[model samples]
Target: MSDLRRAAEEWLAQDPDPATRAELRDILDDDQALADRFGARLEFGTAGLRGELGAGPNRMNRVTVMRAAAGLAACLPSGGRVIVGFDARHGSRRFANDTAAVLAGAGLRPEVFADPVPTPVLAHFTRAFDDVVAGVMVTASHNPPRDNGYKVYWADGAQIVPPTDAEISAAIDRVGRVDALLLGAGWLVHDGAGLYLDAVSSLNLGTPDPGLSIVYTPLHGVGRDVLLAAFERAGFAAPAVVPEQAEPDPDFPTVAFPNPEEPGALDLALALAADRGADLVIANDPDADRCAVAVPGPEGWRVLTGDEVGGLLAEHVLRETSGDDRLVVTTIVSSSLLRSIAAAHGVRFAESLTGFKWIMKAGGPPDVAGERGGSSPHRKPDRLVFGYEEALGYSVGDDRGVPVADKDGIGAALAVAALAAEARQGGRTLLDLLDDQARRYGLHATAQLSIRVDDLSLITAAMNRLRAAPPARLGGCAVESFDDLSHGEDGLPPTDGLRFRLAGGSRVVVRPSGTEPKLKCYLEVVLPVDGDIAADRARAAADLDALRADVAATLS
Candidate 1:
């Protein structure tokens, strides 16, 4: 028999789900389908397993989940404790339960959430308990309806990276005989939602005005109850929720993609906001880990970029609280305006490669250690006032209170509401505040050029071409410096990317998407606001368009 057929047969024999067994049998006659199913196993990297929910080892099913759980369990110390939570996605609860059972069978303690919850809750709880060895959040944040994922967090409450992910992958390879694995009922089940909601409520800055009109939507994922409860606890009036999108529906019928960043994803919420005459609109991704905001702009309701939100929140936190050692963090691809804001407030600023895992490890260990299995001791864990990425991920407050080392939509939403209320009291809107910021700090216009390709090699070829022949000028500005991130620079660990600084105070960074098959080029142009702020903004916008076009051509 062929290798693909043999692997399929083996998988079919051990698969407990009758539906998957039938699926494999039906596809056996098609060689391409069989190879697609059994050609290779789904990779469990630092991000853990994420794929379409279907049969075969290449897909996300019970057998794949079981082996992943067993492999993760093998990486922990004996008798260690684990926390498991799931979102309201197809097969999410079952995956969480399967993970708990596998951990329990490995002689470890497993605490499983009774129902669906946000991904940040799992990250918070993982850090709250010292005895907790790790956490498993079963979700596919903002993916299509037919997809599900498994995310692993270590004891420090950050996503797994490097040596740890590799070690766990090795352990998974040693797993044998899915039928021989044990499944039982000794694990503990608890209401993680309550704990998470209570923690989210504590992030309230102050008593918000009772009459602030707001609109919110979870986009058919599980965030409505917790977000509403948080609003009430923070002393704000109940928001006018998008009735159709309030409930948690795994199918996510309303939107083509569940991510708030996607175009038209927030149309329903915007309509509700317009009808209610609301002050602002807040939206969370399907798993409620990333927050997006929309406000009434001159040209209708416009959603703010992740960089704008990051800058605003950084300013809010700095203004509300005062400390000598306060710090702010963002990714390299994010707008440089944050550095100016941080400097004006005397807050230290830092930049990471691209992900929250590196941003959260700020002031921690310099490199990944094999045996310790967690972040190096933070020099001042309490000093992390705020951290964010261009992908709408924010970590706010001190570790002792919030304990969230990952992106948090609930906490960010609460902060946005409070800021809006304060702005209203001063006879100003969010757009007004943004205008003031642009005047004080130069107008920083940013754009992204993302090219998606069916063949993965296209991305590799583009990167190689850029590296071999670096552009001399971009958008009529001469290139001043070129730094290849692969060899490491400016105290950052080596990563696969390139950064170019233009003579006219513009910048560009090219890198591959960590999760998608796309090559993204981030462009920014900083124009000084000399006279009319509007004219400066217009000029900056035009300059950004030219820069984007030039960069796109260079990549082509």
Candidate 2:
């Protein structure tokens, strides 16, 4: 009779999976469990649906996936074509097939991938096909083994933004009993693997040195075959792959978390790199959309931060490219070193709010005739030569060559390999190149202070506290100015975050994580290189440590 019981009963009746039906029935006797499962439906947003795989409206199951599919079908044009792709995750293939079936039933043409592929492959296909109205990628993308998700991309091969997401959400609200929706069969299946591989191979700027030894690991995801194929096509030697983490395993048993950015995720790869005496190490998250790189240093091997990788790649692309209309982009939280790099290279640069959605838009097509700019002062530039974020996401190719609208780990991996090989030819390492840049552009050091919390409200409380009473000084330097991003300022769109510029040119940006329960504070300090490179690096690193402490104190 209660609302919870009523919703559970309704969901159970339509759920085709016997396991979910049994799950709901067993939890019916426990009020807390029932309420948690049916308390509210998972809200589909621009990123699409992502949650733990289980029963009930709040979880990711056949019924929830079916409803989402039906909603997406209703939102699209009557006869538009849709592309569906999935990774090797629990229930991913089932979810992808369900989406295709639902779209087919809605009188829309649905083309599903023949096998599990990377997320970037889906993004590429969505853009390559002129008839594709939208794209649905069923993957959690770097999340743990127990979770699965659905990501939606528009005709531009980018994730759905603004009004589009809202419109699709409204259509989803109208979706009723899953049983009422016809589950069609015999949808068209397409093999986009070759197309994706070719696109990745095209990103190779020139012939890489054949003797460049490398180590790679997919972290038990689906990136191995695609990356290897790309490398081979680019004329690079076959990389020695980490045997334990080479294949796609839904359980992701080796790593505590599937994301490469997490600590210990690349242990196996690093060990293999040392044993093989490789020149470089590359890793991709479970879905293979994000790439991480590591290099051997004076103190063994160390992973480069996303900021470091962005700077190195930007410089490499700019040096190889020649033109007046060249453009590079990064987020506000990313290191300011990119701005310096762009200016030095005589290329235009812009900063966007966090996320690839804004970064890709800023890196517009070759023609910006009728497109209007966004709140960021650097919106919709003349030509987007390169775009990257601090979270290991990069789009190397422009509109003409590869046409990958989203981050491509495969492309980034190829680029990194080529850069390492070229550096080797110069009798230098990747770290040497980065150090040289620091000397020219002043030592730009960065660190992060991330505090994970069990209770979500703690994050909101921290943000409120910082805004109410801003910090006056950080790292013993006077704060010059503070900008609250909520109301929008400095040409940036309204976002919930704070930015501070210290008198000594140091910077800090604090905000709550959009996808996780945590408060992240990005800290940076710029120290002139002077004459001594080693001493300058030491001093800069120490200053960054001090700045990190000060910001952490403010958050606490």
Candidate 3:
């Protein structure tokens, strides 16, 4: 027998799932298929293990999840409790249960959620307790239906970062035969609804009056029940849910992609909003860790970009909260308008790498992040009032300044509702709030040029070309300075990206998407709004379009 066939047979021999075993048997006679299955194992990254569901280590399956769970167990001290949760996706429940069993067998207490829950609920439970050393969530977030993922969180209620990921990977490599590992069964099926719902409901900065007509959809994932409960508790009338997507459906039959940001994904919600004459539309992606908001204007209904929402939430949070230590944060690729807003409010502002792991870590427990000494280079107070990424991930910290340390779609929805209702009281719309921000902080318009690729080498070659022969000028403006982000300058962690600053605060950042196979170019142009606001808006849009074209040409 060939070596690849032998390897496949061995994997089949110990495969626990009957379906996967049959899968291996069918592919055994196909050399190319066998090679594909056994050629690689999923590598642990900052986001943890994620891939297509299949029968090999290269895929997400029982054996792979067990190995990952064992690796995580090995990194922690015995007897410490670990939390496990799953979403409504293929193999997610099984993977979560397997994680609990492995953690239990490793002599750690395991607390598994009784039902499939949103990703943020698991993060909340992990951070709310002192006994939990770590947490594992089985979800792919907004990935395709055929994919599932494992996300690891530390006791801080944030996703694992840095050396911890490296350490977990080493422990996974040290694992032996999957069939030889002992299994345990003392883990509890937990219910975190009450704890999480109450906390998130309280995030309502103010009671939303019944005048705010709202339409909501969970997009056939797990956000419906929890979001409805939170909204009702927050004193707002129950939102009209998109009936077709009100229940948890693992197949996600309605949308091509489960992410709310995808075009046409929110068609149903928008339709429902129009039918009901609703003032606002809210959507939570498959796992409910991210939120998207849509509003009606003179041009009709449109979904607000994440940066716009971030700006509105930051201004509202800082204005409503009474604290001298208020701090707000956003990713480097996000709009710098938040910095200007923070300055006007006399609050602290910091920038972190893309993910919430770095955001929460930098925002801090106060004692750990101070004076740019140990792990951080800035003075981050424990008062991280708000943090967001341009990709619809937001954390609106409560009055205590203690957010879940991760994105909370449910909480963000409530906060947005409160803010929208307040605006309506003054006969204004969400678009007006955005316009006010533009006038206050100069019109900061942004766009994106994203390129998808089937071959991974395309991305590598594109990055190399950009670095080797940089563009001198783009969009009729000279390139003032170029930054290679991998060198870890400006107190930021080294990442594979490039930034080009243009003449009038217009800039472009090119980087690979962390979860998808795409090269995303973030473009922002800041234009002064000293004259007619309408003319200024039109000029800003034109400038942004030009910048986007230049960026795309340079990258291509």
The numbered model that scores best in TM-score is: 3
TM-score head-to-head 1 vs 3, winner: 3
The number of the candidate with the highest lDDT is: 3
For all predicted structures, in order, the TM-scores are 0.95, 0.95, 0.96
* TM-score of model 3 vs. true structure: 0.96
RMSD value for candidate 2: 3.0
Clashes of 3: 0
Candidate 1 lDDT score at position 134 = 95
Clashes (N, CA, C under 3 Å) per candidate: 0, 0, 0
The residue ranges of model 2 lying beyond 4 angstroms of the native Cα positions read: 363-381, 398-402
* Per-residue C-alpha lDDT of model 1 across residues 37-151, encoded as one tens digit per residue: 7887788887898998898877999999999999998889979989998999999998998888888988889999888998888888888788999999999999999989999
247-357 per-residue lDDT for model 2 (tens digits) = 899999999999999999999999999998888999999888899999999999989999999899889888777765667878989999998998788777778888887
True-vs-predicted CA distance for residue 323, candidate 1, Å:
1.4
lDDT of 3 by residue, 219-327 (tens): 9999999998998898999999999998988899999999999999999999989888999999999899999999998878989999999999989888788665677
Better of 1 and 3 by lDDT: 3
The local distance difference test score of each candidate is 0.85, 0.86, 0.88
Model 2: clashing residue pairs?
none
